[model samples]
Each structure stands twice: as C-alpha cells, then as structure tokens.
Target chain A: MSGASDRVPLPYLREAAVALRDTQQRRNLATATTTIRAKRAAVTAEMPDWEALRVAGAAIKAHTLANLGHYLERLEERVMAAGGHVHWARGAREANDLVRGLVRGTGAREVIKVKSMTTDEIGLNRALAEDGVRAIETDLAELIVQLAGEAPSHILVPAIHKNRAEIRTLFLRAFGIAPSDLSDDPAELAGAARRYLRERFLATGVAVSGANFAVAETGSVCVVESEGNGRMCTTLPHTLISVMGIEKVLPRWRDLEVFLQLLPRSSTAERMNPYTSFWTGVHDGDGPRAFHLVLLDNGRSRTLSDDVGRETLRCIRCSACLNVCPVYERVGGHAYGSVYPGPIGAILNPQLRDVERDEALPYASTLCGACFEVCPVAIDIPRILVELRHRTVERKRERSPLPYGSAEDAAMVGAAKVFARWSRYEAAQRLGRLGQGPFVRDGAIRSLPGPLAGWSAVRDLRALPRQTFREWWRARGAGGGATPGEHEGEARDG
Target chain B: MAESARNAVLAAIERATHQVRDADPAAAHDALTRGYRQRGGASLPECLERLEERLEDYGVRVTRTTADGLPAAVAAWVAERGVQRWVVPPGVPEVWLSSVRGVEAIADDAGPRELDGADAVVTSCAVAVAETGSIVLDAGPGQGRRAATLVPDVHLCVVPASLVVELVPEAVAGLADAVTGGRPLTWISGPSATSDIELVRVAGVHGPRTLAVLLVEDA
Candidate 1:
C-alpha cells in the first residue's frame, strides 16, 4: 500500500477533531457505547476465565504475527493444494483489481457480499461498481449502509448510528417498501431486510466475504456471524471470494478456541456466535464450486515494521476497545474519518498513514487507558500514541530547517540553559506564584487566549496555590515536627 | 483457461514460498503448534470443557454415546425433537439411523428439493474438535456436501470420540491431507443466528437454528 502521503494530506485529522467536539456526536457515542459496554461486560462475565483466555488469545496472535510469512505460505500452499486459488494483494488497488478480474472471469454482473471491514476499508463496492460488477451487501446493517450510500459506522453493527425508525424510513424509501406497512419494531425491520436479501442470495452467482480468522495449518478461513446471510453467501454461490487482512492469520485451528471465546464476548457479547463457517477450498456438488482467498497486505507490512506500533496488528476487529473508549463514545466511529475507528483506530490510523499528516488523531484520546485495559490482545495503545506523537514531532522538526541564529530559537536555547540549573527552576516557580495574581480569578483560570485556549475549552484549570510546597517545607523549619495548624491547613488546601 | 489460471496461482505461491525459505530456512513448521500448545491458550481438557460449556451455554445439549448406541440415541433425540423425517449424509453409518422406526432417511445427495422437505439432517464428522465443539465435514462420500448439514431446520452431527482433537492444530493436522488435496471442507460450530439491531439475539436466521452433536465413543 502506498503511504498516506499518496492519499490526502494530514490536515483532515484537524478537521475531524473540530467536528468531534459537537454535543450531538458526543451524546450518540455515549448512549451507544454505554449500551454495548454493559452488554459486553455482562456476557464476558459469564466466562470465569475470560482474562486468562484473553492472554492466550494475545500470545497466539503475537506468535503468529512474528512468523507471519511462514504461516501465510503454509496457508497459500494448503489453499492451492485444495483446488482453491489464493491471490496476493499488496494494496487496495491490487485487491480491487484482482476481485474485479475474478468477477469478470465468471461473467457475473452482480455479486452478493457478506459484511467485511477489509472490503469497506478498500472501498470494494465502489471499485466493483466501476468495473460494472454490482456488489450487493446482504448483511442487514450493511444493506442499510449500502442503501443509504454511506460508509459503515461500526465493525459488527455497521448501521448502529441509525435507529429503528430511521432504518424503517430508509428501507421504505430505498426499497419501495410501503411506509404504511412498516413498523418501528426491530423484528419487523429484520423481516423486511430478510425478504429483500433472500432474492439476492438466491440469485447471485458470486459471493465475497472477509474471514474472522484463517488457520494456516489447514488452509481454512473462518467467518463467524449471527445472521445466516454469510452462510447463504458462502454456500449457495457458484464462486466464493474471501478477502482477509494479513493479520487475520492464526497458526493453527486450535488457536480458534481462544479467539472463538474472546471474539463472541467482545463483538456480539455472545457465548458463541450462531454460525461460525470454516471452508478449506471447493466442495463438489455442495457449497461454492470455486473458492478464492485474497490475502491482503494493504499497509500491514509497514505497520509490522514499527516496533512500538506493531501491536495494532494484533486487533481482531472485535471493537471491544471501541466500546470502552470514552473518546470513541463521544465522537463515534465517523469522526475518526478512517475505515478503522475508536481507540484502536485513533492509534492505528495515524501510524498506518504517516502521523505527520494525521496528528489530530494522536491527541484524540484522553489517555484514560481504558482501551489498553480492555484490549483482548493487550495492545499498549497509550504507549503507541505517545510514540506516534514523538514521531510526529520529530518529522515536523526535520521538515522545518532550524534558523542558524534566530532570536526565538536563541531564546529557547537560553531557556534550555537556564532550565539545566535547579536554582533557575525554583526562581521561575516563585515568579509564577507572584505573577499569577493578574490571571487568577475565583481560584480558577477560566480562560486562556492563544495556543493554550485548546486546553481550557472544555475544562477549568485550577489556579496556582498561595504557597509552593518548598516554601511550606521551609516555613515548617528544616527538621522540626509538623504543627497541627500546618498539617491541617495543607490537608484542607489540598 | 482454468488450467492456466491454476498454474499461474500455483507458480506465484511457489515463488513466494521459495523467497520465504531463502529468507529463513530454519523457520519451524511446528513453531505455532508448539507455541500454542505451550502458550497457545487453554489446556486440551480445559478447551474441551469450555467448548462443551459454550455449546450448553448456548442452549444446545451435548450427549455422549458409543458408535453402536449412536443410531438409537440419535433416533431417540430425533423422536424427542418430534422430527418426522431426517437427512443423513451419504456416508453416514447406516446402522446409526437404521433402527429409527417410521423415520424416513433421505440421502445427503438428494437434490435441494429433497433436502428442503427434510425435518432435520444427520451426518458423521470428519473430525470433531474439543476446542470449539466443532464438527468438521469434508465433501467425502459419507460426509456429504455443505448443503446437507446446513439447509435443514435441525442438524444432528455424529462425531466419533476417537476423531475428537484437543486443539485447532490437532484438527488441522487431521484434515491437512484432504485440505491440501483440494477437498471441499465445512466446519460447523453451532446453529446459525443474527442480531442486526438493538442486540436482540435471534436464532436460525439463515441456517439450522438447532444444532445437535452426538459424540460417539468407540466400544
């Protein structure tokens, strides 16, 4: 994959950051994330050893990633030996072209697709349309997104942003379903979607999917889903194409045991998904006659090269981190302005692309560390964010030539000199206490003008206290016992 | 054209494999398996218990029986489900379903028309896994194709105890020969369901809503 430099420049993140401050976005996120968070917690709590399973799941992925090239080769060999074809795609363009070529080879005008985030990330539907191969999304939420001509907002529940009433309205308007007959009830909405997709599933000759995990040992690609639509798309079609990210590989089928437990709890918050379909290759007189597995790198190799940021590749797309993210709850997935959204998205998107362009994403988090706590794979998100920030700053410094002797630069040089001395730091703190009288109001700095304004926009900053700790310590007399008045005052002030 | 496409794909893989070998010839094929076993995740027995726990947790009952008793046990289970007709994979051991009085047994190879009329489908698994309680079916003579196990309202998969593997690697090893040979394989974990909106759990959205696995032990 070409770097983000080849796409849009970095300023888009700044624009998204501005949009994220909206109260409507925050409310939507808060309501949705809270609901998902509670449900996930309740379901995960059912497993007594969920934490242990999470550790195992993370270790398996780390081991697999370290030996990715090997497992991928094994997977490809097994897939090819099974009469299945495996295609390698370095980026979205190659993947899209490969899929288009396959569809054209089959002479299929339209193909039914199960929901796959990799496809969404690569804009597969649009690419297929350009190639005159209409891609119909059969997943209920995906159908809504496709019908609305919108991008998916969530990994599992793509149309989570749309409420039942809105979905009913969209269905009626888009599919010509009578609004008079439609009810706001979810079951009715689902029934409507089922009816609409049933014909597509039966008629489509080609089906495309994204695998949850690909076991290299057996060359099996597994797709777990609640709706049977994946089953229809996978089994009924004459030709089946599965697009998967390179990171989805697990070295063995047994590794699925840990993930199967972790993913259901993390994504749908289920004990087990209703349908976990695993296909090796083509079956005779049953399922798809032809099977294609598209192994996509699409910027993953770049992600793997970064020692600090490589952990982002461990994500299973379960969105457990997203559900627990305070920032994600506020901004929702769209505000990230990338196919990947939420806590993982914030760190991952900037790193996948040059962070110099997407600087706004690194600052998106409050550094609450909730994401790190909830990550099943234990990706150190906060650490990655800080590392990305350092990278961004370093890149900026390298881009701008430092003036040989500019006054501003010289002042910074002087300040660095002064800061090297402890006496200077102590004097500066004392000066700040005396100088704060002009700005301090009601024990809070209510407003800050200029670059510091961004910090004070949503929060009130506490004014500096009357006495510095050093001053109080000195006033107490070097080694004397603390007086009750002094102790009480310090406690009350704190 | 098919032959050419096949060769091209094979050539690409061979080239990639050669490159990997040149880069790291000592990379262990069994490294992942060893890692998984040592640090892969849960223990074999624990994984099996968890799988059974998950299956039962999802409202599916698990029954253990010997191969000789499988037919009677499955017959009784089918009777209990009130299913009048059942579809059996072409390779299903005939004795397993022979004793079911008055229940019509349809071959898995029966056209979609015949399968559509069946109440439940019964099949023997290529391998049964303890990790996921998953029944692996390759389109071998007895196992039937993917459609036979999926289309029916209820699916009764008989997994020989001896075939049950401790982990996914063990399962993969068992199926490696068939998989590498291009045999069509289907792995079933549980009944199908979808919850589109509001997190309402719905079952049997596309495939069988009810999945029954008869774990048969060798006598």
Candidate 2:
C-alpha cells in the first residue's frame, strides 16, 4: 500500500476519461452493476425489518468504533486466551512485514490467499514476492485478476470487468487448461479454477486472509464467502494469519446476528451466503493448529479522528453502493486507482492515504444519492463526499495563500463580491457578456481565462447571452409573472 | 518492534477517541434499541416446512424421514449416487449407517487430504436456521471437524426436525456456548457456490459439488 500510495495518482477525471474509452469494460460494468442492483432491491424489499436492521447495524458499528480502544484491547486479550497469537501493525509496510515474517516463520516459500481488500491495500503479494515467497490467490475472480497481472476492478467480484471468453482465455493460458476442460461457460470457468487451485490448497502450509468481522466478546474471527477457497485457506493450512483493519471488530458475539442478516442480503442479494466460518482462536481436532491475528492500523486511526470520515469505517465491505453508483457503473473501479473503489473508494482511499494525494477522488461522484440510499449501515456517502471536497479545498488554501486561495477559492471570492449588490451584478453580467465574445464558439465557451479555466478544460459552458434574466423581467414592465397569459407563454418556452 | 507497534496503535486510538466520541462506549452500546425480532416463530412443524422450502430453493435436496427411516435414507442416497468412499465423522449415530453396504465408510477422524479423497461426508449439526436454510455445524455431535464437511465434493447433513429454529437471531442466541468454548462454527446454507463470475451464480465450487439433507422427525 505504501508503495502504491507513494506514487502520485493521475487525477480521477483523467483516469475516468481513459476508462470511458473502453466500451467493452463499460458494458461489463453496466451489466454487472444493474444485475446486482435489481437483486439487492428485490431481496431488501421483501424484508419488513430491513430498515430496522440497517439502523441496528449502524448503531453496533457506531458503538464499537466509539469505544474501539476498549474493544480492541478486549479482542486482543480474548484472542490470546483462546490460544491465538496476536500481532499489531501501525502501517501497511509494517503489516506486510508482519505477514511475510509469519510466512517465513512457517518456512513456507509459497502461501495461499483468500480474497482480501486489506491484503491488496497493503500490497502483501508484491512484498512477499520481493522476499522470494509466492502468494497465490485462491478465489476464482481473484485468481483471474492475479493471473492477468491487473488490480481487481470490483470489491466482491474482482474480475467483474472480464467477460467469460476473457476468463476462459486466461484460464487456458495460465493453468494450461484444455479446451475440453474449460469453455466460455461460467460453470466451466469456475470448474477450471477449482481444478487448478485444488492441489495448491492442500499443499500450502501457510495461508493469509482478511476478517469480515472479528467478535471481541468471544475472540472469534469470521469470514464470509461463496467459493470454499476461504475455507481451504483458513482451514487446511497449518498456520492461519488473518490481517484485520482495527475497525472490523464487533463488540459482542450476538452483534453478528444483525450483520449476518444485513451483509449477505446487501451483498450478492442472498438469503444467506453459502458459507460463513467463525473460529475463536485455535480449536482442538479442527481447523488450523496455529491461528495468528494481525491487527492493522494503516491510517485507520487518522481516519477515526475525522468526525465526518469515521463513518467510512462502519462499512461492512458489502459493495452494495458500488452496484448502485452511476459513476462506478460507467468508469469502473480502476479509475479510482485504489484497492477500494466506487463510492466507498472515493471517500475511503483519501482518508487512508496522505491528504494531498488523491485530491480529485472526492469529486468523482455525481452525488445522485443512490449509494447513500442503498448503504445498509447508513453511511451518508454524499454528505461525506461534500465534506471531503470542502476539506480538500481548505487544505489547498492553507498550503498556498494566493491572496484569497487557489483558483477555485479566488473564483468563489469574485462571485461573492459580484452578488453582494444588484447593480454590480448587472454591470458584471454585461461585462461578462462583452468579454466572452472571443472565447465563445459553436454556441458554447470551450475555454476561459485564469480563475474559470478548469471547468472549461473538461466540459463546455453555455455562452452567456446579451441580456440577463433581470433585464427580461424589467422588459416585462407591468406584465406580472402571475398573469395567466404571460405564465402560459413562459411555461411553454421553458 | 511488535510491542512498540501495539503501544503506538493503542495511543493513537486513545487520541482518536476524544475526537469522535460523544458518549461512553459501553453506555452507547447498551442504549441501542434492537427493534428487530430476537426470536419466536410459528410451530415446529411449520418451521420445518419453511426450512425444507428454503433448502430446496438453494438446491439442497431435503428428504423427509422418520427417526427409524434415516439410516435407510442414507443408504438409498449412497446407492443412488454410487458414492465410493464416505467419511462418517465421530458422534454420527452408528445406526445411521447400519443399512449402508458396498461403500467404504471412513469412521476414523480424517485429515483434509484424506477427506478430499472421499466421495462424500454424512454428518449431524448443532442447529438449523429455518429462515435462512442454514445447517449450523460447531464441530459438535456428529460434526467431526471443519475440513471433514468442506474438502469432500459432496456433503450430506442431517438436521433433526426439532433442531430447526425459526430465525437467524434464534440460531445465534443458541450458539453462545460454542462461541465461548473456543469451537469453530460453519453455517452451510447450501452446496458451495460462487457468483463472482460476472455476478452469475454457479454452484459446486471448492466446498462441495452437491449437498443433501435428511430431515428426521426425531433422532
């Protein structure tokens, strides 16, 4: 993560522009998101208590995060008592080092992995590879994304952008799968992945994963999945290492009753996912013999300090918002340039990284409020996006005092002065109309000077006409807006 | 290095608490109004019927049987499927497999690799949630270990009618002992499945290709 975060990101608008050119990927995203949105709406609409469950889910996360220090300590104590080793890491590099060291301790040159955004965020595979240890992705979509040497494009379905034929080709090339063994059928592609990873699951000595929820009351770690790859990783391995962001902790065991209902229904739109595994440390005659829980911070504490941004931690990683987001449905996840993507990514990636980098991510959304409406934990994504935008502007203004602020800041100041009095506003309007002659072309202003230039760079602005609305009103004279004949004409024209 | 990291994280959390908290953590947690239903449902027979419906909806074949007919049902399934090797975990009623013939019954506790070689596994459960059609396994009774039911291509789970609960919360409330006692739990809803490929559901992944359930009246 440090490695990825260190590099300057291409602005989100530019990245999204490039992604928009890929019509095939856009089609894949649109179909996938639309399908998931319909499925989620149907399942949620059937539940009478869906809203109440969302409130409860939100409340549990709120309470846990409020007393996160207390719960984190409790979780650590309980895990140790249950015969699991607990390690703490303050950053992504530290986390990777801890996991890599654990794998080294097991003396295993190769390890299997469950699909974990936290691992991807930390760049654990790359870190492990540098140390001569290979981390093999076991989830079918993750395996596909890994084999393609690309970042995952979606949270739940990592290879959501890849079509069946693309997946078949990857499988055929990567696994040396025979055409008879693999086809464009999703079932056959899944079978090919299963057959390929079956041997690796049994042979691997160490496995690393991320926790869906870690119960602090009883020291249990839970993983929710459909493919048994999670089971293979957490169960078959001799040593199990789970890297959990500090925010995943649930205060009590019963809290799972709320989340278990909320998450599956929200994600993949299922009554219940096929498999949900919960292990409290190591158990005799079952699962991994050695259980290691690595509690990761990685800028989470900084995120927690922000009153508005802390709600980002309440996300259960459902990715429901992604399915319903208009921007995400079109531009896809890669445009966000972070492990987390879509609405959640826009807000989360900036908070989890440096303040200066990824400045435009907060502006990636259209703020249609679909994400906030579908969010199970009630994370007001729009409200947070607005807050991040303001914070971004403030940060820029603070860093560079250009008399008033940045170009945006100066523009706002100029507009404030223009609107203070009607006479100045009218005069300025006339001045603007006169000044726009050279720039206005094709019935739109494609470029502008100094303070107003950024807007014209990506989008065309409608040229200001010769007369203002006030002028039109003045011209109306005694012809009031309330008069039916005039009103009819105005309405028809509008 | 680990020790300092722990201390540093703890210190950071302490600082962050003042910025985010408006009330005490325990008090805020206790003050939460759990408006959703905690438990309570229809009659046991009605719950069992609903359980059967949900299990079938997920492609798990559920057989209705009396206590005495459970073993014959297992045998019939084994014969029909032509299962070659089966792992019967410890605590599974020995009489449940008494009628089965021609198949190698693996009774000893088998490791993952050994279970992977087996064609199927027949096991019991701790509880079954009728609402979600999930058979809960806590490595108790007939349920041997987590991997025994997972590694094999087929999983045959036995859910006694009386064990079926009406809701997920009820099933959760009943698992406090398993949680506190350091026992691992697997809530199997159906055969292993994945919807990751273009969001299309394709069943039969690494867990089990097929899942069948025997719903006995009393066992």
Candidate 3:
C-alpha cells in the first residue's frame, strides 16, 4: 500500500520515535481527533438506541462474515444479473492487475478515482502506472496528499496532517496558480481543486473506487462521503471499477440502515454526510454504463480464522477507534507505518499481514479501552490487541534459533514453573522480598538488574510486599461471615 | 484462472469460517438480534418540520409552500439566484418554469458540456429523510442522471410531503426497489462540504455550492 513493501519495514517503536518529533503532525492529530470525538459523542448521545444500533452493527457484520462465501456468491450473481461483471482477487497483485486491465480495456490513459482505502491497500494506482495509465485521486485530501507525495495519515480525512497553508501552497505549485490567485482559506483551496478536477471528472472515461458496503441482497454498492468527489468518480465515468475487501459485503439491503446511521455519526460525527451514492450494476442512461466489482481477499480470509481477532473484520473503517485512541493522538497515524493506523490498525495490520512482520503493532496501544468504547461496530479492539500480542510472542518463540528459545522465553518458562504451584510461588516471593533491599525506594522498586531492568525502566514495579495475599487473607477475618465492604476495609488497611 | 481464483477464495473462506459455513446463511442472517430501532417515533408533521430544520442546519436555504404554490416558490428561487440555462430533467412540472421568464430550460440529455455550462439543475426527489435532512435521488423522473445534480453550480430540489421519511431505516425499506431495479441513487444531505482540512467543517466544494430546497406541503 505504501508502494514499496507490503509489510512495515521497521518496528513500531522506531516509527513512533520519528513521528513523535514532528510537533505539527501531533498537534493536528490531537485537534482533529478531539473535535471529531466530541462531535461523535454529541450525535450518538442524541440517539436513544445508540448502543442497540452498535449491537446490530456488530451482529450484521458477524453474520455476514460467518457466511462470507455465501453472501459473496449471491453478490456476484446479483451483480452479473444486473449487468455488471464480478471478478475474484486472491491477493493484492491479482486485485491490482484486475483494476489495471479494466482501466486499460477502456482505452483511457488516465482514470479518475474516488478515495478508496482498499484500492490504496492493493496499490492499484501504482500498478496501473506500470502500464502508463494514470489514476488521479479526486478526493480533496487525497489530491493534496498525491500532490505532496505522501501517504494518507487518517482514514477518513486523509490530509489530516496537512493544514490550510500547506494545501494552498501545494495547489499554487501543482495547478500553476499564481500566489495572488489563491488563498490559504480551506474553501478557496477546495474551489481550486473543483475547478482543476471538474473537466477531468467529465472527461475521464474510467473511474476506480472502493466500496463502503456492498449489499448482497440487491447487489448495490454504497459509497458515503462528504464532498461530491465520490459522486463525480462513480457517476461521470463511462466504466466504473470498484475494488472491495471481502469483509465489506453485507447480507442484505436493510443492513444498510444500521451502517448509514452508525458510519456518519461515528466517522465525521454528523447525523449524515453530505453525499452517499448507491448503484447496482449498470444503469442504462444514468451513472456508469459499465461496472466491474473486484472482490479482493488479500489476507482477509486469514484474518477470519482467528475467532478472537475476527471481530476486526466487523470494522466499518469509521475511524472512531483512531480518534479516541490516546496513542494515536500523540504519535499520529504515520507511526503505525501502514495505510491503517491507530488502535484498529494495531490489531488489523498484524492480522491482515504476516504476524511476524507486524508483531510490534499489537503492542502499540495503551489498552485504555477508548477505542473499544467508541467503535461503532463494537470490534472489541483491546481484546484483539491482547490476543495478537499473545500470538506474536508464540510465533517469535517458535522461530527462535535456540532449542530452549530466547531469554524472554526462559523467563516465561521459569515463571510458569514457579506459578504452577503455590509453594514455589511463595518461595520465589520470599526470595524477591529478600533481594529487593537495594532497588526499593519510597516503597516502590524504581529499577531492577538485567532483563527485569528494561520492564521497570518505564514503569514502577511495586516492591515485594512484606506479607503475601494468602497470608493477609488468613490473618484478617478467617470466618466466612465477613461482608465485602469489611473485607475491602481490611484489605485497604493491610 | 479467474474461476480458479474464485474457487480458491471461496474454499479459503469456508475453511476459515468452517464453524458456520454449513449453516444456512439466510438463517444465520435472519437469526441476528436486530436490537436497533426499526421505526422512528416522529409523526408526519414532525418529520416534515424536522426535515426542514435539519436541511437548514446543513446550510441549505429552505422554503415551504403548498403543492399549489410550489411553482411560485420555484420561480422565486430562480429569480433570487438569477439562474440562467437551468437543466430541468424529465418529470419536473413544466409550470414550475412557466412562471420564470428569463432562464433557458434545458432538457435531461444536455451533454456534460452543456450541464457544466448550465447555472443550475432542478429536480424532484425520490425520497427525503427527516432525521438527517437528506434528500435521495434515484435517477427517477425529474431526477434525470447523477450528473444533473452534481456538475451544476447550484442544485434546487423539490421535496413533497408524502415522500418524506422520518429515519434512515424507513427510507431504505422503500428504496430497496430502486436498488434491485438498477437505479443508481444519490442522497444529498447538503451542498458539498469538506472536513479534510484539519477536519474542520468548510462548506462549498466541487459539488453545487448553493443548495436550496422547496418543501411542498399537501393541501
């Protein structure tokens, strides 16, 4: 998706360290995400059944994914019946090739694009460039990022990292508009883009898009957006190709009711976005005359295999999780080093890629639960992150060179021995208490030696208590008649 | 090769979700607990009033008129904007433009060139949602094509009382026909907006900047 590699090159800590130094990105992310967070809270609170809607959204996605193959077949049949063609893509290469061939078949050198993350995930634009076909991003943010030669920092607002002045400067250079002719006003910059792309929208014969949701019941593809760019790309082109991730398909038309309400409120924090387009197949005289839907598997089936992490597929890409994530706020999206960034990215990136390549992503969250709280589909992202972390460690241990594995594995093995029995654990605790004299300061162990030193460096590990929990429990109120409040008081005192 | 890819993908999905692959997808879907509200509690009058309020909240200039006064309202909007060469798609009432003298009314088939050159496009909506203040065009009758409403500088939409639905669910229930019928639809919540710049709400973009709605109440 980044065009150079399928996997993030460096670990998350390395990427995050670089991103943390960019104060502009951090500030912009904080402000944008905070604003959206408040707005989403407001709009969602107004609905009495907001939680129920979330439940329904989760259920719908789970059901669809459970029968993903069945729904996909139905979608293909319905799309073909409605005068559209459906193609299957096993991976990024296949999906990109399909889109490239479709655009080439139109005999067009340049194609217009709606802001599609799935297309970005497959690197379709670059793939098309190999054949000398140009794909122009029509979304305002996307166009800005394209001109600046950058990746989209935010899923919803791709140019969230760019401010008005940067945009104005970029447009002035790219469109060759004189300095006096353009202003840093967001509206003025948008107007400049409109003027620049209006002709392109009308003239471009091929358009590429990503589906927000594809209804299997009616074979309709839904795209929800604020600007009319999505409308332009889907409507004005003679031939439209929509690349959809397998999980995007929903079981029925009525399911849209849940998503339409959930997405806008959770995505941009509005009751509804400015524009949403739904088209099925090819209309005779309106919109696209020819339509192609490429169903891209692209490791999605692999993601579905993990029962704990499968809820990651339920994500609608609303960016609610990103906006609410504290880690995402400070480090911004770039640190995740993938098209997806934030808590959802933390879990999704690893699951959708080779786990070893993205092992660091799963550990990139504070587990504050804000992302899970705001997730429109109830993705349980925190739970998924924990599960992925476990897998990452397990995978790493399996691939270690030593038969006995690494030091971390040795420590875990030793801990398992001691923890397996209460007597050994008690003996170890007594040994830890005896050895803590040098490290304990102000009742907290601020530092430790060797491998434990790294874990204690960033956090305070409490000194081994003078008495253990079992000892305390035996000493305080041995009778079974003790009330919970009494026990809380005694525990606090102890 | 394509069929093989399709078969492989299907097999992979079946293998991944083997727990539910053999179960009836329809049954699994139907068995889902749809706890969300199906019907909005608003009455018809409330729906109309809310629709006007919400549409106006989106910066759309809204006006109300009876079915009889709709043409006069349209004439007022046209005169107010000084719109010339308006593209009136098929199924728009001829009387709406009969009162407005100066503007040249173009037909539905005016090429993209003509549509881009036109000052405005006016059409009646297929349905309107009260909760979100959104108007849906199903490329039906007066709605013409998606380009008519999109390419023009200004879009004036007519929302009839009977066509208003109170919530998103209610609107989708009726629009399923259009989806299966292969009528591509556009739901315009307001004139174009972009939150891409620092996620700040900025109005007026590539789509029509000036959007006005005429809500006609039944007499």
DockQ (Cα-based) for each candidate? 0.26, 0.77, 0.76
Q: How accurate is candidate 1 locally (lDDT)?
A: 0.72
Question: How accurate is chain B of model 2, given as a TM-score from 0 to 1?
Answer: 0.94
Q: TM-scores for chain B, in order?
A: 0.77, 0.94, 0.95
Q: Compared with the true structure, what per-residue lDDT tens digits does model 2 show for residues A177-264?
A: 6778666999988888888899998888899999999998889999999988998898998899999999999999989999999999
- Per-residue lDDT tens digits for candidate 3, residues B140-217, read 888888888888889998888999988899999988888878788898899899988877677877788889998888
Docking class of 1: acceptable
Where does candidate 1 chain A have its weakest 10-residue lDDT segment?
A1-10
TM-score of each predicted structure versus truth: 0.77, 0.93, 0.89
| Candidate 3 C-alpha lDDT tens digits along A1-494 | 22433444467777777788899888888889889889999999999889999999998888888888889999999999999999999999998888877877888999999999998887887798899888899999999988887888889988898888888888999999999998887777888998899889888888999999999988899999988889888888889999999999998988998999999999999999999999989888777889999999999998898676468999899999888888888888777878899998898888887746578888888888999899999988888888888887788778888788766888889999999999999999889878887887766788789978756754677666676667667666576454456644543343
lDDT of 2 by residue, B15-71 (tens): 988766656666777789799878755898889898999999899999999889988
* lDDT tens digits, residue span A8-108, model 1: 42254444555566665465556667887888888767555667777777767766665667778789888877679988887788889899999999999
Interface RMSD of each: 5.3, 1.3, 1.2
Clashes of each: 11, 1, 0
How well does each candidate reproduce the native contacts, as fnat? 0.31, 0.83, 0.85
Clashing pairs in 2: A1-A122
DockQ-based CAPRI category assigned to the predicted complex of candidate 3: medium
Compose the digit string of candidate 1's lDDT tens values, residues B79-197: 79988887866666668877688888787767655776799987777876664556677676567777777667788777666666655556666776675555656666677665666
